[model samples]
Target: MSQIISGLGGQSLYGGLNGINSSSAIISNTQFNNPLESTVDYSALIRVLVTILQQLLSQSSDNTTRPTPTVADTSNNSQPFNRSNNFNTASNNNLLSAASNQNSEDDRNIDFNILSATQRDQLGMTPRERAILHLWGRQVISAGKQDGGIYTNVLGADGTGTNWANKAEVELVKELRAAEKQQFGGDTGIFLDQLYFNLVKEKTGVDMSTRYANRPVHFSSGAVSIITDINLLHQRTGLTEFEQGALRLFGHDPLINGKFDGSVLDYTISNNNALDGSRNSSGNPIDKVVRQLLNEDIQDDGQRNGSSLMKSVITILDRLYSSN
Candidate 1:
């Protein structure tokens, strides 16, 4: 056995099995003669061989069949993350759409054509009356008064009695002169002084005189007198014939009262609130007639062409003077 072992390159039994030399497991000559010692070496070698066989079996099992390395499918693994990202993107888009819709709703809530009750109360006039006065004031400002002449003469009271078109025209002219003197401080140049004062008060909340003190040229002017002449006033004001006629009839309708009432003149010229047909204080659609008039005047292109505005004034007059 020793010769066979030496023939195998003097390797121990355990070393031979593992393709290595082990001096401790090598059978010695003296240990082989002692049967007990030889038996002890063989037993130790058997134990080591058993341990190596067990290790080899474990290694073989590990090498042949691993747990398949549990390789993750990246495509499947990223699905939840991708889904999370998509969900987040969709949520953001929904939020943006909601915000845009809210903004549009807010924009739709604004109604520029309608005036509030507080605004009507502060202006102390009906919407129709305010619109009429605003147009009239603009006309007066455009057709300035005469310079260096009796204001009454400029208003068709030349005493020649030739300029008077009719008794009605003559009466209207007299009422205008009286209103200019009594309410407007005889400053016929500043015909609609109250309108100007109200506009200044609305804008600056200051006295009209204080605003125009440094700029008196803007306060009053003598450019072209046209208040007494309807045709001339129309030319200056760009008001249509029907509109001018409506305003004239509003001032003096012989069919309604048959005479010029100073109270009517005052109410027409002053900023006093109109009691009749002024119930649409909130500018709501509850007053369909007034709301329709406002819609036509403010929303329609006919307002620019003077057709709708004429209709609005005519409707108001028709309501007031039922005979017309």
Candidate 2:
């Protein structure tokens, strides 16, 4: 019987499915030493193999354009990363103008509580944005309920809080930690700050860090609730219009659009199954929203242009918040 043996250095492999003792299976090195032997096209063979390997690599790669990473200067590495130049002068001026005009309108006799679509249009906002503002206002009024209450309460004189307020920041921090783990494989402890900044840029195409520099890291349920309070939103700082829109639509809007199965207001948070393709499960509304938003960029890069549903919502909100 013929045995398969390891060849010496510089010897090529030779084997075949023949009789166990067949000499035809044995390839002698002397075959190549023969001067009359014809030469094989080794270069052509190599090129063909290389081409196959390259085609395989191309096939395995995801057929989508990945999102471009935003690079910020981390000069003061000692302290937590606090970015500068969060937004451009144009957006800042527009926000300031809108806020100022909205405040002035509030001072007038016409009640915002009863403002119609026409009235909102006169204020330079779309019906959808106006609806979001009104819904947000109602949520603020129901602050003691499951969705929690206002965090800053700039509009209210008492500045009272819901049962969820005391733990809102803590809960938000926990939510971010979990999201960081799921999205990027680990929590950076600075995920919230960085994400908030990114959201600002995504929404307004400007960097806006100073507005939220001293703001508390924890976000209230209202910040993530589907229904938001327009008056309370105006009173608060730190959050950009884009971030606010994301909170409004994350998991909260499914019911409004007939997409969510359960109750409209989910009081007790559970596993938060929104981003995991299981939308029925309950958890902190804010957490679910954050996960849903961040997961869009993490899962596939091709859809990044419209990455999260929040991106579309933010575009609408921007027009509402704009001077035009």
Task: Encode model 1's per-residue lDDT on 55-95: one tens digit a residue.
Answer: 45655555564444211221123232121212222232222
Task: Report the lDDT of model 2 for residue 210.
Answer: 52
What is the lDDT for 138 in model 2? Answer: 36
The alpha-carbon deviation from the true structure for residue 302 of candidate 1, after best TM-score superposition, in angstroms, is 31
In model 1, state the lDDT of residue 99: 23
Tell me the spans in candidate 2 whose CA falls farther than 4 Å from its real position.
Answer: 1-15, 22-168, 171-199, 202-205, 208-278, 281-304, 307-311, 319-324
- Candidate 1 worst ten-residue window by lDDT: 253-262
Best by TM-score: 2
Tens digits of per-residue lDDT for model 2, 1-324: 112221211222232222322222332211344446746344743554455445445544534467663111111122111122122322222322332243321111222223434443454444443333333433322331112223223212333333332233434445554575576554332354444445445434545345334433233432433324434554443344435435444434322212221121121122222221123222223445444444664564644332455454445434432311
Error of 1 at 1 (Å): 88
